[model samples]
Target: MFDWLYVLMKKLVENVFGLSLDTGIGDSVHFFFYDSVKIIILLGFMIFTISYIRSYFSPEKTKEYISKFNGISKNVMASFLGIVTPFCSCSSVPLFIGFVEGGIPLGVTFSFLITSPIVNEAAFAILWASFGWKIAVLYVVMGVVLGVVGGIIIDKRKLEKYVEEYVYEMQMNRPDIEELTFKDRINFAKSNTLEIIGRVWKYVLVGIAIGAAIHGWAPEAALTKYAGPGNPLAVLAATIIAVPLYSNALGTIPIAEALLMKGVGLGTAMAFMMATTALSFPEMVLLRKVIKPKLIANFVAITAIGIVFIGYMFNGIAHLVI
Candidate 1:
């Protein structure tokens, strides 16, 4: 019956909502809406389901689990939890706000914040399927390390003192955004499917637009000159250029692929890819609402430094072969 409801509701959504119902992009989905939508749908469901479970059970209890210690076990769990939360960089500030309000420890919440944007479902699925398992595994490892270390240091520094006073007052009187059962989880998934997609469709479209432009018109000579082999500074240049612009995984891969064909250094392209994924303009706009300018500045600096290191690592790795 629920399966029937799911299908029927999907049909209704297709007819009334006017989303493209064209089934399947047959693997090159980073370039097509049909494939992208499917990815979004699967991701939306996962987010909602996880949110529902966490909301219902640990929304309150997680504080205890985290606050008991500040060691490897906690940080490691924090890192892996980052993987499962599956939110986009755009969603980080809001998710951060929500988690803090729900009484989670600062370090744990920061772990989720760092990892979600740097690595996400869209990134993992597309990279693993397109690139290979090795790249995907390395991506996951790097993201987790960044998230865990960033979270722990921020915690040790007592940055909680820097949290906005307004947020404090709000957390004082927080209302119930609580747990749900099986049926409720379904409703939660459907609602989140729309909400998550709605917040991000603009970026997704922008990514696709940027990708298509790169695919069609990018100059081979331009790619080779500054961002090519023997250019150690290319990684840094890509990181600087990418931070101001936003391109989630879906959009950046096409451009990266184009650059790869143009003799651009893979390491430089990788830096740009990480920057666009983890530090986009849209993400900053959203974050500004939650974090004060000081905190945002700090967060940006820390994350950018991590990306730069990763960028150099990529360049070093490439030097080994190319």
Candidate 2:
């Protein structure tokens, strides 16, 4: 549906503007315009749909479900809930604090934290739009697996002792908000869709602009030489670089698409996306207020190892599936 729409839009733009969509600046323009429209349309629909689905459940319900699980199932439940919880990394600290104070295990909370930023629906939407369902499914599976494994490792180490003493002592008093009706949910979805698209469209444009420029002007030889699947260190390099950089997954998706178009390896692109979203210096710094440096270091190290493994694994198998 989107491909046909893109073709029609491209033709319309060409006819309306008296420009070609196949060559030089026109090619770049068409790529940017087509991708921008496609991504925004997908983003709105996906966000609204997910938000409407979310209306069926509440945060209290999610916590209840998370608290009920034990062992590996606990990690799984927490990680899955993290994807649907609708909180950004910065706001997650308060939830984490509340969970810990309410007697939820540290490992389970970590599971939630690990997956929340990494496997969001916005990222999923863009990945689906840019790379298709196979890769999108792969990304979600790997993200959840990373969360589960990281949580289990933290559980084994009995790292609850490493959490800051102050977190347990602090008391929170939150007022409950009323649940929304179906009509309210519809309104909420509309507002959320607009708000998200309004905030990120510039990033999308910038990313696509960079992508469009590279698509038309950059030399594929240089990109292929350095970040190609054949390069043994490309995945590692991408993962390492992404650790400190800070960008939302939505913003990074277009750039990753561009990199792939310019001949960067699939694994390398995946690793970069994982690193930027899953692990970041600011995230670590924020976490330090609640967790000791040693545990924080372990979290980073373990997550990085998993991300690198996924990068290499995907790079090796991407050609087979893609």
Candidate closest to the true structure, highest TM-score: 2
Per-residue lDDT for 106-152 in model 2, tens only?
88888888988898667778888778878988998899999999999
What ranges in model 2 sit over 4 Å off?
A: 13-22, 170-176
Scored by lDDT, the top model is 2
Compared to the true structure, candidate 1 yields what TM-score?
Answer: 0.65
TM-score, each model?
0.65, 0.92
> How many collisions between residues are there in candidate 1?
1
Each model's lDDT comes to: 0.63, 0.83
Candidate 1: stretches off by over 4 Å: 1-69, 86-94, 101-107, 172-225, 247-249, 318-322
Query: What's model 1's overall lDDT?
Result: 0.63
Q: Can you write out model 1's per-residue Cα lDDT over 1-322, one digit (the tens) per residue?
A: 1344345545554666554334322112323433245445545655565556443433234444555556656776666766655466656665666677766667677776777677765565444433445666777888888888877777776777667666655654445765566887677666765775676666555655554455445676887887786677888888898876664445565456556656787667666767777777777778777667777776777777887788778666764433
